[model samples]
Target: MALASPTVAQAQSGTAAQCQTSGANSVPELHKEWILVGWDKPVAGQSWDFREKLGKYYDWEANDVVLYDDMSPDFQIARSPEEYRALWESSFQALRRAHHLVLNGPEVIAGDKLSTSTLEFAARLEPPESQPIISVRARSTLVWRCTSDGWRIVREHNSTRRITPEESRQLFGF
Candidate 1:
């Protein structure tokens, strides 16, 4: 579906919608929209086209609480792109039978660098528990940044849960 056309002022003016620094990084708001766009299509260039969305957020050193917290040597460093994609595919395949999706972006911590917005998502399953099939809706958040390349994802989080359309209506008002 086409996304709503909320003005930049409308986005930044809201509590959950603001991700940019008026003076420092104009990337937060950009990131928020990029995340929405990421859902609609591929982001940035095709450098990571081989990648699927599952573990793609690992491209950056951010986590969605399912993985490491801040300050893991693992988080401080990442595998080669090839290795990262392998892990992403593995995770995606593992999740093939589940439903719903959620991903949260990173909250800015310190430094002139911002941590991008959180990508929160959720989904449901067919069997409703273990050994279930993934046949439900999913949603996620993506963090965006203005890069030497262009606006791109920096961090994201993922999950799964079942939600009713009424709940979705309350969540995104879409």
Candidate 2:
């Protein structure tokens, strides 16, 4: 007999309905949904596609979204939808040029009107000619709010896990 695949395994064991079904009243499921649609899908997009998907999950009307990253000292603040569009547009371009992102641990908590997710992930930057791929791990906490449409992110704070210079050199190979 053939072994059941992971997708089939979850479905057959009733865990899929418990954690994959929308409207199933499961926190894990909602968390799973948010993470996939919010981060995973956007990172997988190319060129214009990433921007399109970024707008979907972000709350444009709030007009107070703040994105934090390790590369900058100040927050990447977007006070308006136009600015929001610009930030993500530039972000997608950088992602397209510099690195490939992958999502890892997503610990989520669903609340009455707001939810939070702590995501641990890494980006593998394309290296020079024949150098080994360089990877950097970071963690982000995302704040989500329920809207008439659905859940949307209102704030995001991302920080790189502290690494020594030697550790960075080893991993990134300078």
Candidate 3:
């Protein structure tokens, strides 16, 4: 499948509505739902119950699943769903509050049994005990496969950079 390039206008308009309408396919919609269930809602609710909510989106028994998250340590290459769960649970422990805002595409390329998408986002995170808030900008690419159970992520890579306080203020209105 060919990847569709976003127009300058579409690139600048990073609203949820824009994301939903940018692609004329079900993959984009499924991507949005995946993000909402896996990240957005749990983060918004400040809940650490990720394994349960995110279980359906992953093939826990698959041997080839992988994740690379830059924010994690050198040992953060999770090759199994259990390892990913541990990583997420560890991250959640340090966060008192976290909010993620989608900044760009789920620009997607889809096929009969496989699809991939890229997403850019900004996050505001607060640490426990009233520590100062931290803001980060990040991007991620996810590969999903159509398994008998449904669409499940088989690979993911994410990278993040800390945003300056001033930049955070500009982006998040703090």
Model 1, position 75, has a per-residue lDDT of: 50
Give the whole-model CA lDDT for all candidates, comma-separated.
Answer: 0.38, 0.54, 0.71
Sort by lDDT, best first: what order? 3, 2, 1
The segments of candidate 1 whose C-alpha lies over 4 angstroms from its true place after superposition are: 1-77, 94-115, 125-130, 133-145, 154-174
Candidate 2, 1-174: lDDT as tens digits: 999998866554553232322363333344444434443423333454444645656677785666555644245665554565665555445443333233564677766567777866554443334554345677778777665445667877777755554655555455
Candidate achieving higher lDDT, 2 or 3: 3
Counted clashes in each candidate structure: 28, 0, 0
TM-score of 1: 0.34
Best by lDDT: 3
Model 2: lowest-lDDT 10 consecutive positions: 15-24
**Poorly placed runs, candidate 2 (over 4 Å):** 1-46, 72-75, 94-104, 127-134, 161-174
TM-scores of the candidates are: 0.34, 0.56, 0.76
In model 3, the Cα lDDT at residue 21 comes to 24
Error of 3 at 128 (Å): 0.7
Residue pair clashes in candidate 2: none
